[model samples]
Target: MEYMRTVGRWRRVVRRVAAVAAVLVPLAVVSVVTAGPAQATGCRTNAHVYLTSVYPSSYRFENQPVDGGTDDYQMFAGDSTSFQVGGNGLRPYTSPAWRVESNVSGSFVFNGRVAGGNCVANETTVGLARHTVAGEVWTVRANYLTGNSGQFIQNQAHFRIFFVDPPPPEPWYWQPCYYAEACF
Candidate 1:
């Protein structure tokens, strides 16, 4: 009779332990599986400058970096190319003007007025690049000269700038599981 009682107590203890483990083991696994990739703590935005031509003509375009370096790229008419404006660290709500030069000559017309002369003609025309934060990206646009004659030249080179923001940080509970194995 005593042996039977002892066996019954042992079974109850085993059942309790199994029930606790059933709950905890799955919880640990779910914590691990549901935990996603680490996210950036803060928002770091970057400016990307894109250049496209409206007219179907090829012209030489140059991009001057913020750190005082120059890169030349040839853009075909109705095509686009992109580059980052600010080097590694980009400032928010800042407009960084880029030095864009083209071999084509003429006066640039922007918004119904002659904005500036061509880089080939004046050699000092700097595109007044401006940027605005639109959601996760910063948008920038500039107009430059294109074509041969100054008589029929309009703003041919169109620059579009975008500010790319970093992805949002992970949830509060997921941080511990992602960074440390203590949650498991």
Candidate 2:
């Protein structure tokens, strides 16, 4: 009789525990389903995009005044696609600040930091410049939206990171005044 009672008590305890778990399990699952991947905040204004590496060989990706430029050479700034280094206006100041209408997809429009044309990647002639990369701060899987026809290449990498930052200020120049100009 005692054995029967003990068995009945265990069965009741199991039933109670399962009933609690049945209610809690669904809530936990529902929370996970509702939470999805975070969205990209798009590009910033007046920002300088640089390789995340600090090595001397680490270089900034720049554009040629060609029909378009790199964003054509490789998918991300850190990808292993080697290319010809140096081109016309392939300097740091010449490389335009990237403005994204979306995260790292669709079109990566230039902030017009450079003149004439912006998104030109002439793979045939003056191709993009790449350096002995060290590492990248972050990355972007962006498809080059050429100002020219048909578009040259598209960046298809899923999720990635690239660093786009504001250019650091130089303390050399006095902002309020310039050469030979008297202070007001």
The all-Cα superposition gives candidate 2 an RMSD in Å to the true structure of 19.4
**For residues 74-143, what per-residue lDDT tens digits would candidate 1 score against the true structure?**
3223222333222111122223233333323212222212222211221122333333232322122233
Tell me the tens digit of each residue's lDDT in model 2 across 1-184.
9999999999999999999999999999887765532111122212122322222222222132222322311234432322222112222223323323323334343222232233222222112233223323223332332222222223322223343333456667556878899976
RMSD of 1: 29.6
User: What lDDT score belongs to each candidate, Candidate 1 first?
Assistant: 0.33, 0.34
After superposing candidate 2, which stretches have Cα over 4 Å from the reference?
A: 37-184
Measured against the true structure, the TM-scores of the candidates, in listed sequence, are 0.26, 0.26
